[model samples]
Target: MSDKRQQLIETALELFYQEGVQSIGINEVLKVSGVAKKTLYHHFTSKEALVLATLETRNQRFSQWLTVQIAPAKNNQELVEHLFQSLKGWFEDRVEVLGEFRGCFFINTAAEFRDSESEISRYCRQHKSDIKQVIRQQMATYADQPDETLLERICLLKEGVITQAYVAQDMSGPEQAIELLKGR
Candidate 1:
């Protein structure tokens, strides 16, 4: 991507994540990104197109971050532990580029979009499925035969952690997730 296009995406992602998609205007994104209105329009046909691109950018970034953060796991137990640890670090703003956690971006987008048929909502669902696939891949490597139920349970725990930490401001959610993992 050109510098202008990349800057617009990054700026829009930050604003859309911090503020709701509907709350942040195109002009605001252009101003924050230091890109001209024509430049943004040239890169993205419409505000919805820009929003989709922003979602795509965030999905790539967040998935990669999660993968890197948990890459050191040596076993199933370690994998589970590292997953929670990553969440804790994210909740505490230890990830420098991510800043403070504002809940899962995909989840936030889903809630904002509401309509299941909407493009944004579809992207949100796809991002979530991709996350579950990542967990399944890791579990498969660590187990002789990974159970789908176990994979779902782990994903549930992760979602719970994100929700509790972001909504209730309960930092212990990751620890609770670890305990849930231990029981499994």
Candidate 2:
């Protein structure tokens, strides 16, 4: 991507992640990115297009970060533990550029764009499906076959932790997840 386009995407992603997609205007992105309207429009035909690009960018970055966090796991249990630890770090604001825990970006976007058929909502769903797929793949490492029940439980726990951490400002969600995993 060109420097101007990258700048616009980065700025828009930051603003959109910090503020809801509906609330952050294209002008705010352009101003913060130091790019003109013409330039932004040249790269993104519409604000909706820009929103799609921003979400796509975030999805890639978040997935890559999660992959790295779980890369050192020697087994499935360690992989799940590392995943929650990474989330705890995020909730505590330890991840750079992520800023603060405002819940999952895709979840927030999906909530803001309630129309299930919308492109933005589809992207949000795709991001979530991709995360669940990752969890399933990791779970398969320990079992001879994929265990759907365990996968669902872990994914649910992960989602619950994220929601609790974001809504209640409670950083213990991950620890609670760890305890839940212990009983399995």
> After superposition, which runs of candidate 1 have C-alpha atoms over 4 Å from their true positions?
none
- TM-score, cand. 2 vs. native: 0.93
Write candidate 1's Cα lDDT for 51-153 as tens digits.
9998898888888888887777767778889899988999999987676689988888889875898998999989989888877777777678877786788
Please report the candidate that would top lDDT against the real structure: 1
lDDT of 1 at 61: 80
| lDDT string, candidate 2, 5-41, tens digits | 9999999988998888899998889889999999998
How many residue pairs clash per model? 0, 0
Which ranges of candidate 2 are over 4 A from the true structure? Answer: 141-143
Lowest lDDT 10-residue stretch of candidate 2 = 135-144
